[model samples]
Target: MRSEFERRHPGVRIQIENIPGEGQYVPKLLMMFVAKKAPDVMHLDASYASVFIDNDLLLDLTPEIKSDDSFRLDDYFTNVVDVARRGDKLFAIPLDFTPIVLYYNKRLFDEAKVAYPAKGWNCDDFLAKAKALTIDNHKEPGKKQYGMHFINWMPLWIPWVWTEGGDVLSPDGRHAEGYFDSDKTIRAVEFLASLITKYHVAPTHSEAAAAGVDLFRAGRAAMHIAGHWMIIDYRSDGIDFGVAMLPTNAASPKTVVYESGLAINRSTKKRELAWEYVKFMTSAEVQKVRVSGGLAISAQKEVAQYYASDEQERTFLNAVEFASGPWGARVEPYAVVEDLGREMMEDIVNGTPVPDAVHKTCRLIDLELSQQ
Candidate 1:
């Protein structure tokens, strides 16, 4: 991409500095920003765009997008594009995204004589299949297979909240007073907890870690609710897996969407050149190259068609239509919200009353938002 961009524009050179991982990427970028030495063009996680925008550190791309005849913002998914905006102004253009979906082990379903999950299955259907697939030691000595595997992460659990018709914060993103502690949200937490404490269909946090194997990859769990990034790794491992949309609950089916976009530093002297690079990076040619290589779901709708070689891969592309961005896109102090959310889940897994955990976490989130 750098070579092509340089070829397109004579006398202009592009140097790429790759950051290893998300853990070190954000801090290093922040330090560079503080020193006014940040790159003219950089990638920003959708979750942290609000923070950079709040700090007035990101360039507003609205004018450039509006003026460019070749860039049709409507061609991209509405929700994904919305994540890069703070009201009417766009700060970046998304390059790629991955939406959460249901990944099931076909071998396990066949062995249990259970039908594969169909489209638009509800929570009741999920529970029934999970119960049927779970195997106890009495059934088979020294081998116990769980029905589902859930990692204790905010992104994994937030879909439960959304499916149950609940949210972590208010629509205006000001407070979490009633939303987080409401009956619907508590019910979601209770249902997730039931997978461990009540139904015994999923492994506890400690048990999963101690097992030293990914339950889904090892074929010890029948279903895993995760993102598209796992497809390549699972395929390489020779696991017989299939994909389906996340089951519906009280509301329509929903899942969390994660995306990374390219944005320019607000203080850059080379705004024109940076915009050109951003346009080229998200262009159909570049996106096609990325999708063909199985890197990620491309941001362009036209380029995304390259990945639909199988039904499972097609399921992932279809899932993007209904996926919504994470709560951090709207709420400030999202790190605090994420930490408190994980802590609340841990409390539930440790046997704290669901209602009590929800109430306490709600208060803590409200306090954090108030201070901001």
Candidate 2:
């Protein structure tokens, strides 16, 4: 991708710094900025973009957007484009995004003679399908089937809580007092726990660990809640899969969007060139190449349609309209929040009272936020 850009600017060299893992990228990038040696252009994830933006280490692209008459912001999905925006200032042009959705095994649903999931299905409908699809093979234990796949990852499961009108943080990202331990949140937490413990449709944490593989990908589970990125592996495994809007208990569906974009350093000497580079990377022509691998839904609406060869892919495009940005996109200490959420779930699954677990977790989350 860097080579493609360098070819356009004959004398210029686009030096790419590849940071290899999470928890390291932001610190390394921040150090570069502190030392006045940051790169002109950087690949930014919407989740951690807040750290850089809050410190004013990245350039606001609003002026460039106004000056460039040929560039069109309408080309991209509106939800994703707003990820890097803070009031009047825009920071990045979205390259791609993945909205969290429910993935189901078509083969399993057919085998169970269960109807496929449809949009606007409620939590009751989801539970009924899950119950029907589950198979307990006491004789052939290795061939047992589960209705749903459960993972304790907070980000992946938060949408369920959201659909129930519960959240871990306030709208302004201030505190978690009323949100995380509220009556609605407690119900959401207990309901998720019941899927594994009481309903026995989803595997327990210990059972999943014993399996040592992705139950959904391995065809041992009928339903999984995840983002678009899982499609690559599912297709490679030859699994006939379908995507659907997550079941909601509220008036509407709610899901989180994880996105990646391009940004310019505030100190870059080649400001205009950096802006051009950002535009080029997010251009529909470039996005077409990027989404061919099924990595993510292109932020460009037209490119997303071009990328969608089948109904499964089209569902992702439809989902983009209802998805909202993740909390990590704006809250700097969200990693700590995620840790607490996981711990709370673990406590519940291991015999702790749901109310007690939520109360403890909510208090810890507030303490973590106070430190920030």
Candidate 3:
């Protein structure tokens, strides 16, 4: 990224700062902001973008994007633009999006001789294939292979609900109103839980982390439900795998995708300069480079075309077309809603009934939204 910046603008200099992980990103950035030494530009999760924007810390890039006659906003994906929206205002433009994909060990499938999931395949196929890959502890006790592994995170689970034609919040985003009470939501949670409880095809969060992706890397689990970020890790391990679209019920085939984008610090004196850098970062040319380098899935249609040469890349891009909104799905008071959802998810995964967990989460979400 720094090289690209330097090459493009000879007179300008670039400095790249490395942050440890997603967990520490915000608090550290917030400290920088408090010290009035925030970077000219920074990448932020769409979920947490509102925090900086709400505090008037983000520069409104609308004028720069509009005034620049060369900027064509239509080139980017609609969902990317939609996610960056803050109450009808455009504060930032998306650089890339991370779409969820179901990765399976092709070698394991070949060994088990189970069929691969095609583009139009549904959850029924997923279950059948997973079962075929799963070996019962008592029967095939020699091998400790499971069918699949989920992150046990809500971001990963949201798609299951969406596939069942359910969401976390109401249309108006005013209150949760028990969206989880829907049969669709219940069924989705049940299906996910059954992989562990009934089929023995998946492990709980603790077990998976202790084992790590080594289970999948060693072809233990036939399939893994994960995001694009796993590409680097899997690639480094030199495993033979195939990325497939996230499975869904035929009735509602839209998969769920999560994303984040870059926002310029409003307090920066070089607001115009920051916008220019942001514009360049999200442009098709730059985005294409980023995507081709396996950095991210660019939001621009033209940039997204860069992934066409690779089969898994192509699979992920195609999956985005059927993608649904993020887990919380609402824009306002995102942190509160996300925390509430996370707590409920942990409760249900730890053995609480789905109905009780859903009800509790919905009530908490309602209260949070009301406070907002």
**Among all candidates shown, the one with the greatest TM-score:** 2
- Among all candidates shown, the one with the greatest lDDT: 2
Q: For model 3, how does the per-residue alpha-carbon lDDT over 1-372 read when each residue is reduced to its tens digit?
A: 667776877777767676798578878998899999889989867656666766777777777777998888888887767766666677778888877778998888998899888866887888999899986667755457888866666777677778777777777666677576677777887788877776778876676776655578776788987888788878888878899876777554676667767788877877766777888888887777677657678888887875767898888887877875563334557667767767776677788988887777777777777886
| Residue 40 Cα positional deviation in candidate 3, in Å, after optimal superposition | 2.9
In TM-score terms, candidate 3 sits at: 0.87
Q: In model 2, which runs have C-alpha deviations exceeding 4 angstroms?
A: 140-142
lDDT of 1 by residue, 182-283 (tens): 888998889989999899899989878877899889888999988878888898999988999888885468888888889999999999889999999988
Task: Give the clashing pairs for model 3.
Answer: none
| lDDT pick, better of 1 and 3 | 1
Sort by lDDT, top down from the best? 2, 1, 3
The full ranking of all candidates by TM-score, starting with the best, is 2, 1, 3
lDDT for predicted candidate 3 compared with the true structure: 0.76
Relative to the true structure, how large is the alpha-carbon lDDT of every model?
Answer: 0.86, 0.90, 0.76
Model 2: which ten-residue window has the lowest total lDDT? Answer: 14-23
Better of 2 and 3 by lDDT: 2
Clashing pairs in 1: none
Question: In model 1, which range of ten residues has the least summed lDDT?
Answer: 136-145
